[model samples]
Target: MEKEGLQRSVEFFKHHNINIKTLVTDRHVQIKKWVRENMEDTTHAFDVWHVAKGMKKKLFALSKEKDCSDVSPWIKSMVNHMYWTAASSANLNEDLILAKWQSISNHIINIHDGHSTLFPSCQHDDLEGRERHKKWLKPGSKVYEKLQDIVNSRQMKKDIPMLSSGQQTSELEGFHSVVNHFAPKMIGFSFHGMLSR
Candidate 1:
């Protein structure tokens, strides 16, 4: 349905002589393939919110594991890193974005130097003790290993670069939220009423 909707919308726009240059969407494999094979002119990017949402869920699960409770403290920071990588990356260059995302593995363990040639070290000022960096995760430990695994997963390598850099679908999402609030699916409304909303 997503692919079909995208195709129909793209077709509709093309019929009206509107060419889409960049499309920000969740990481949908079929859409990726269709956009690649069908719409050569359009650039497809995955929204950072969806990417971070999945990362957060995985981290939360990892934190629940025995001996990995230490990871709980860094969950928010890890998620923020995803957002930061998307927002900070210029032109959504895949290599630079991937380099920045990979840096988190070292940063979480307080091993910041030599992260990457592209992003050699952490960019922010040194963390103020309590207000900034949390208790750092230990290196060569189970938590660190699991986190590194999650951070550098095969899927992450593909998805990190696909993250949208700016002008995401948040406004559309907000409009949907407002529609749900005013005209929830459970309640039926007349055509005029729904149209007004």
Candidate 2:
């Protein structure tokens, strides 16, 4: 189905009393526009990792113009911070972002589209002694961290069995074997032809 169709489905689901608090999706312009227009009440979050990856790619491309290896590592670290800031309920304070921005020689800050709502509560004004912004911890910080830890641990455990085995098998080899056995050939194709049929 098309974007509009998917959005209609989402609206239909909501109308039917489906409990969808937030919609996590990639940074598609159409989807963003649709959500902004139709689903104002529902929280929308762009995939943090996808955003970071895009930033990294752009940074790498820009690095070609400016001869600097050090900047690449810094860009990577900043991208990682974006992911962590998004994933963690920990607020990404404006001061913290400004600090990182100031540290970089290039104007990487300008590239930010400002679509992400998942940011630190503390604004630029909050840094001043005058404004009294509440310093309450984010609601789901601990839970988010715990969930990430669990996923990482599970992935590590899954990899352990693969690490123990010395014999390595390529997926390409398996694919080729299946294709050769299944495809009908002109010569000596008795069992293979039957299998294909």
- Per-prediction TM-score: 0.89, 0.44
lDDT of 2 by residue, 1-197 (tens): 34866578797897999966676655566877788787878766555554556656755654454333333444555565454434433234543433333222212222223423442232233233421231222224543233223223443233211121111224444675777665634456577566665
Residue by residue across 1-197, what tens digits does model 1's lDDT show? 88888889998999999989999988888988888999888888888888888899999999899999999888888888888988888584688889999998888877878998888998878778763657888899998999999998999999998888887878888988989998997988999989987
- Show the colliding residue pairs in model 1: none
Error of 2 at 102 (Å): 7.8
lDDT for 188 (candidate 2): 68
Q: What's the C-alpha lDDT at position 69 in model 2?
A: 39
Candidate 2, overall lDDT? 0.45
Give model 2 RMSD, 1 decimal.
17.8
Shift in Å, residue 186, candidate 2: 28
Best by TM-score: 1
Segments of candidate 2 deviating more than 4 angstroms: 90-197
